[model samples]
Target: MPSKKDKGKAKATDAPPKEITQKDLEKLAKDVDKIASKVQHRQEKALAKGEPIKEKKIDPAKEAEMRKKIEAMVQALSNMEQTGAIKASGRKDMGDHKFWNTQPVLQHGEDVTEEGPIDPAVPRDQVQQEPYPLPKEFEWCEVDIQDDKQIIELYQLLTMNYVEDDDAQFRFDYSAPFLKWALQPPGWRKSWHVGVRVSSNKKLVAFISGIPAAVRSHKTLHHLTEINYLCVHKKLRSKRLAPVLIKEITRRSHLEGVFQAAYTGGIVLPTPIATCRYYHRSLNPKKLVECNFSRVPRNSTISAMVKKFKVAEQPSTPGLREMKPEDATQVRELLNKYLSKFDVAPVFETDDDVRHWLAPTPEVVWSYVVEDTKTHKITDFFSFYTLPSSVIGNDKHKSLNAAYMFYYAIDIPEKEAADSYDTARYTKQRLTELMRDALVLAKQADFDVFNALNLMDNSMFIDDLKFGPGDGYLNYYLYNWKCRDIKPHKVGLVML
Candidate 1:
């Protein structure tokens, strides 16, 4: 869902939108069309080469028809805060959310003075014992992810139809090992790996999944499921399969004793507890431009672009090294203590959970720590995970290897009790130092891009590290719970 996030979010149009003129909408359309066209052009060029690729762009009946769509999207979003009537890209507003309005999620424009679940919880015994009914031709299936054959089938389905860029130049290429690791975190339920299939042919076409997690919102701690990978075959999206997939996952999660859930999306729905912008630091600028992931700016040369993103060949942290099994205890204490400063975060109950999540998994995650050389005590830590994207039409580059910033912690004084102003500033400097090493490590690992969301203390180093804001925005939503809006820095949890 995060990768196929062309739906865009609030960075384009905020709630209670300001008055925008007809001229403003027209101008925005030109900018949007130009960005979309470049990526489309790159995809076609690759198709003519030897690599087999799907042709997504059709010759427009008239250029005006294409422009009309973009103009309509701009106008619709400009009026969204007041009217809640955006209908482009299969998205619906709060009032037009026929399916969502009936759910327990908070509605858009509802001034939230209290933070709690919108609906009362039902006993698990009272929950539905049967799966939601599907069309006669289709049926529900609980995928056994441990089985090799089934895993292959699920991988094939997603590889062909999962998250794709708007111009179709790139699609998420999640590996089988990654799926096994992400879906089988501590306390994961087999039933929560929900899927749909054609009954006769037994072909998997749609899927959604949830893993157990403990999330803290403001002052309250909750046992909730982290829902993700919600994908429906492209041809069947108009069939209203998305809502069904959501309902099925909720039902499965409820039976597993999870009453609340959290999810991230590229579009604004019902309401967002928090919204974060995606920032990308190019590790391989030349490959990114060739794959249409980024562009060489009008006034910039390739060498200039390359020079701007360069980092130290070696990390400067004195005692930094790869984290070991014994470091789990210190890391948990550090991460939990650090996360407590945020308004929303996860509450880790034990060090075993930390090892399960943060212990380095080769090819899946890379984590490192900074220890006090004199005392031999851990002082700070950082980590990132691998998630590569298929560069659809690039003849030379088959994949755009990306490293997504994950759980990281540093020593910082609480905002309320600061001994000196320089302490906070010093912490920012230390974070920049750690982050620069992360960039260098990502480059050493041969990643084409390093991405991070505007969450936690990321704002401190984002600009200083030369990361640029991306076209995408991820909206954080709490499934059954409701709360006041969460600002970026206040958001601590990062959903995969």
Candidate 2:
């Protein structure tokens, strides 16, 4: 009763499903069995090799129940994947990532304890006591740097022992000009300078120095004393005398009504919170190549690019000059702009931070600025300040000669948006040029060495200058601190 087309359709429908022979089913089963056997063998070998088995030590009934539960989960996942209801991989949520990364897994029967929140304001218990007893022969005497002879001896000792190690940019040579500037009278406090001496011999052996922190926007209500230039003579390093010097300095700080102290050093020595991150930039392509500072390139493009860039000098179009009071507003803008690119930068709120950092005691702080004279706009700036050494003994008046570099910036023109990388390259190039200028200034000023930290991206810039990696690194430890909503700039000093 059907038409010809209907009969054809029915014939197509009548075709039986293609038959899978028993041999095919058997082959599939064998393949699966082989795979399962291989997995079991691997697991067994691992166990024999002392790898812990995943099996939990539970009652037999409980073990069986757990296996069933796991099997159920596996089956549910398989079904969901097969039905295209869920992804087979890359299904991680934020919570899953956090849990995987941060959450600790507890072992069975392990005790669970919670750590109370940390209080930064409360100082932790001292771990190690002062290594050596205070020398009875040495009288705890503070030296009046006002005395020209004492000041000259102090400078001589610092220049001899604490002089710039090979990697310093600005050399701290103990010059007569510097002593005169440092010891210039009335307001300079003797309490800031302390020394230890053997009552028998009037040799100045150990020394410490502190300076008031007065940078605006970065100022602390409590006077902060920076402890720096701590060195024991090479022969005396083993005497465990560094701690005594540190304790003595602490006593002085407390006497001065100072509760907090900060210093940067190479070793993660005294305090853990003081450990700072180091950033480096490469200046000399040949040096970078020799030192293995350059990263291995994934391809030739990067390698060729670096080689080409290295051969060329960064363009220096802007003129540089000493920073003036009028340049504060522009300096602040530039600082804020450059610093915002980083996670941490010096906190500068008011113009005072700029003044203090740039002009701190005209004799101690030196600042330089690069400008577009035609436009009367400042384009870049950098500053450095002197940090004195800690006091040890009166006879061994050893001063640690050092200077800190701070607040550098560069601005790229709007027209050069496409060539900003070139602008940055030029900016870095300018640092080298300016450093040479700083060196000349430092030599005249009689500093042993100009010390600056390679924080964040500045590390990259520092390497370009051929500066030796300093043993000293600055660190940050926060106290009674709440996380501020604002993110800091990446390039400048992070600590206030």
Candidate 3:
């Protein structure tokens, strides 16, 4: 704008900035394409050689952050599964969470496992061995009333594992109650109570008890011993002790002039006599369900019936008469034939077992035999007994009461002639008729209740009898044995 040098300085200061053109933009694009192609070629070559692609290095701090996030996600999933908010897939589902989370994996069949910390209370080995040692000076003795302590101990030992079955009433713990009852004033005779003792220590570890039978209704006699409270210690079970006890009891029974002995167990060990069915009358439906006595049914009426029928009474029948002692031998023959139909029979075959079961007492057992007077032979026989009543909240009602329909037998004159006169069918018909007879006798005796156990096959007959169901049933287990086909029997009445 002025002189040549000044003008050039001014012009330089005022010069305009150059703008980017399409050509320059196209050149930059080409350079970017070249770089991308080189990167692609490198990646292809690396991939062909099975090498990971080259990546730009990331910050160690960022990598740690990313790792923590992934770990947290995994933990959340596990937590959800544990809380049942989510389910685990595959093999994890098969394992119990308590074992998986708390216990270490255990080796199969090993006595010990790494499942968490071992419980010090539990034994390392649980298998029991056989051939238990018996006391050197052990003597089998008849129970004398004076030997109250020994008798009490024997009862305690037998009832140690007394679990009331789903079908029993008036729960009995064999030991304590037996001791208390046996030692009451005018205590049970020592002869009726048989026990095995270590001669040195006089520790009464095993025993078998019996009570004499008496007359009941219908001119029938009961000459039998009711065997009960048989028990042995766990350590002494392998000593083959029960049969010895049985033989000793049988001897005592014969000494007492008894011919038959009756008892019950879950399994028919020692004897495989007649089998009985089971029926349960529930007291509390909810409680029964909780205790597994009865399952909750879909029909409320069935459930209500089981719950309410526990104390209901059946109508009494007539034509019953008191039993007589003179009828002993005839009753014996009838019972023998009755028992002979079954593969299992009671342990008492000798006069000993029979004598003990037949003696009269305040709590007398009675028998009634309906006879064909013209034929001068017995047609049917039923046995029952009286006990101090066990009805709750009624002190006045707790008097001598007749309970337990123990056993019954009917004569089948055409057994050999009639093809259909087998044990099962005959038993069913006889039992049905026996119910009618029982009702008649109950009414004549002015009894408020008559109870009978629906033993194994007898369940088929129970539904027909209109007998009220009971809340409890007896359970039996073998002391140290197994059986192939021991048929079960109904609960027969016996006097203690």
What is candidate 3's lDDT per residue for 1-496, written digit by digit as tens? 0000000111122112325332343345345434544654575567568888795433323543443343223322322333243332212232333322332222222242221222222232332222223356677666564455754565555444232222222223333433434333221446667667778887777766776543211123345565666767656775667766765665555555554455555321222222232232222344334433335657666457554434325423233344455555666676666655433343234343333343222344556766665665666667654432222223333222334455555667676326542444456656666665665555455543455554423443555555533322232221111222233342233234
List ranges where model 2 is wrong by over 4 Å.
1-134, 163-188, 214-223, 233-237, 274-315, 325-366, 384-406, 411-452, 459-491, 494-496
Q: Per-residue lDDT of 70-98 in model 1, one digit per residue for the tens? A: 53455345335323343444344347777
Best candidate per TM-score, number? 1
**Model 3 scores what on Cα lDDT?**
0.43
- Expressed as tens digits, the lDDT of each residue in 354-386 for candidate 2 is 665564355566787778878888877777666
In terms of lDDT, model 2 sits at: 0.46
List the candidate 1 regions with Cα displacement exceeding 4 Å: 1-94, 413-417
Q: Please list the C-alpha lDDT of all candidates, in the order they appear.
A: 0.78, 0.46, 0.43
Quote model 1's TM-score. Answer: 0.83
- By lDDT, the better pick of 1 and 2 is 1
**Model with the higher TM-score, candidate 2 or 3:** 2
Candidate that beats the other on lDDT, 2 or 3, i.e. the better one: 2
Clashing residue pairs in all predictions, respectively, total 0, 48, 48
Model 3 ranges off by over 4 Å = 1-143, 146-227, 230-320, 347-362, 387-402, 415-417, 421-427, 443-449, 468-473, 477-482, 489-496
Kindly give the stretch of ten consecutive residues in candidate 1 with the minimal lDDT sum. 8-17
